[model samples]
Target chain A: DVKVTQSSRYLVKRTGEKVFLECVQDMDHENMFWYRQDPGLGLRLIYFSYDVKMKEKGDIPEGYSVSREKKERFSLILESASTNQTSMYLCASGVGQGIVLTKNIQYFGAGTRLSVL
Target chain B: AQRVTQPEKLLSVFKGAPVELKCNYSYSGSPELFWYVQYSRQRLQLLLRHISRESIKGFTADLNKGETSFHLKKPFAQEEDSAMYYCALKDRGGKLIFGQGTELSVKP
Candidate 1:
């Protein structure tokens, strides 16, 4: 089975604080992704990394940055946390990405629910 | 731009009844469609994919290229099937765009 693990299940952070959400995958996937899940918004991609030290912006990358210093790890950073940033954050990884938008399959972590006050 | 759309935010049904969760997408190139399910306190997992063309847990989805849709259907809903379902579109970049999601509620 593919195992994607997150650092936290629930977190509380004050506004303007720097926040880090960590994720690790045991599947040796080449692609890692970060997403925020809102009630009606579903899962919106924030950032993704195809290889170590490589990153790309997703549909919603504002107020967020990502790091992939190691093969098994991908981290999502909030430079300055805000109330609007409070949500359930998800982490995912996959092997070689699809040739087009429809070919890839991303396996996900358990999720980290962060609350920014 | 490539996009995935789930018209329903919530779907409720009694156990043993038929159920369908709709998903539609817009993409120029060949797309791979998938259904991911997240049960309470569980990580999101792949339920089914169009390319695989298999039914899981009694649920099946047919990808209609002409209609640009892949709607998941089950002959009978189960209580354990109640969860959040997301439809995703993987773009040429190999990244995924997810739909708004549909929450399935099955009551006895």
Candidate 2:
């Protein structure tokens, strides 16, 4: 089984403070993604990385940025936290290509619930 | 517009009763549909995909291109089967769009 771990299960930060969310996957998957889930809106992608040092913006990338320094690790950075940024952040990793992909099913972390005050 | 719509926000059924979660999509191109489940205190996981044409956990979903719908159904509901179910669509592009999700509750 693929194991995905998040740095924190819960986090609280003051507004205007920078925040860092870390994720690590043991399966050495090439594709990693960061998504924020909100009530009624479901899960929206923030950023995704196909390879080390390569990042692509997803639907909602206005307040977020991502870094992939290593193959097994992906990091999501909020330039400055705000109350509106409070949501459940999830990290997922996928191995190969498109939808029918055998390894494309992303293995998700337990998710980090961030509360910005 | 390319989007996924899960009509029912919440669905409740008794144990051993049949249950179905409706999902519809509006996409002009080839569509790939999948059902994902997130149980309480657990991470979101894949339940089944239309491409595989397989049933998972005794649940089956059939993608009807003519109607542009992929609804999940189970003959008998189990307490453990209750979870948040999401219908996702993957266009020809690699990106994915998910529905609002349906909260299923199985009562004993």
Candidate 3:
């Protein structure tokens, strides 16, 4: 079974504080993604990394950055946490290939619910 | 631009009733569709993918390129089937665009 593990289940941070959400996948996937899951708004991609030391901005990448120094782990960083940033963060990993079959099928972490107070 | 849209926000039904969660997409190129489910207190997981053409937990979805839709269907929903469902589309860039999602509530 593919396992994607998030570092935190729930977190509380004050405004303007820097917050880090970590994720690790055991499947040796080459693609890792960070997304925020909000009610009504659904899941919006924040950032994604297709390879170690490489990253790409997703649809909603403002105020957020990502790091993938290692292939097995990806980290999402909020430079300045705000009230609007309080949401459930999800991490996903998938095979990085040119094809669309299993390459796009992602396995997700349990998610980290962060609250910016 | 590739986009995925789920028309329903919530669908409530009694146990053993039929269920259909509608999903639509817009993309110029070939789109790869997938269904992901999140159960209560559990992580989100892949339910099925269009290319696989398989049924999972009694639910099935057919990709209709002509209609630009991939609606998920189940003959009879069980109480355990209640959860949040999301439809996603994989664009040529290898990125995924997700739908708004539908919350399935199957009551006894």
Candidate 4:
């Protein structure tokens, strides 16, 4: 089975504080993604990494950045956290090229609910 | 641009009653569709994919290109089946666009 682990389950940060959310996958997948879940909006992609040092912005990448220094780890960074950034963040990993049907199935980690006060 | 839409924000059904969750999409190229479920206190996971054309946990979804829809259905709703269901669309590049999820509640 594939395992995706997020470093934190819940976090609280004051405004303008730098926040980091870490994720690690054991499956050696080439793709990792960060998403924020909000009521009625579903899950919106924040950033994704296809390979080490490769990153792409999704629909809502503002106020956030990502790092993929290694294959197994992906980190989401908030330059200066704001109250609007408070939400449940999810990390997912998938194998092979994302275009393929079977390979595109993503395994998600238990989300980190971040509270930016 | 590719998009997925799940119109219903919340759905309630009695146990043993049939249930259906509607999903629609808009994409120009060949699109891959998937249904994902998030159980209470659990991480989100893939429930089923349209390409497999298989039923999982007694639930099935058929992709209709003509109608641009992939609606999930089950003969009977169980308490255990209650969860948040998301409809997702995979673009050619492998980026998935997910719709606003539907919260299903199976009442006893």
Fnat of each candidate: 0.86, 0.50, 0.75, 0.84
In angstroms, the error of model 1 at B57 is 0.5
Judging by DockQ against the true structure, name the best candidate.
4
Tell me how many residue pairs clash in candidate 3. Answer: 0
Q: lDDT tens string, model 4, A1-117?
A: 999999999999999999999999999998899999998999999999888999999889999999999999999999999999999999999886633324568899999999999
Q: Best TM-score goes to which candidate? A: 4
For model 4 the local lDDT of residue B12 reads 100
Separate DockQ for every predicted complex: 0.69, 0.56, 0.66, 0.72
Top candidate (lDDT)? 4
Question: What are the per-residue Cα lDDT tens digits for candidate 1 across B1-108?
Answer: 788999999999999999999999999978888999999878898899898999999999998999999999999999999999999887766677899999999999
Candidate 1 accuracy as lDDT: 0.91
Error of 3 at A75 (Å): 0.7
lDDT tens digits by residue: candidate 1, A34-107: 99999999999899888899888988999999999998999999999999999999999888642222247778
TM values, all candidates: 0.96, 0.96, 0.96, 0.97
Candidates 1 and 2 compared by lDDT, better number: 1
Lowest lDDT block of 10, candidate 2 chain B: B89-98
Colliding residue pairs in candidate 4:
none
Ranking by DockQ: 4, 1, 3, 2
lDDT by residue for model 3 (A3-91), tens? 99999999999999999999999999988999999998889999998889988898999999999999999999999999999999999
TM-score of chain B of each: 0.97, 0.97, 0.97, 0.97
Interface RMSD of 2: 2.7
Question: Residue by residue across B26-101, what tens digits does model 2's lDDT show?
Answer: 9997788899999999999999989899989999999999999999999999999989999999855576678999
Q: Kindly list the per-residue Cα lDDT of model 4 for residues B26-79, writing each as its tens digit.
A: 999788899999999999999999999999999999989999999999999999
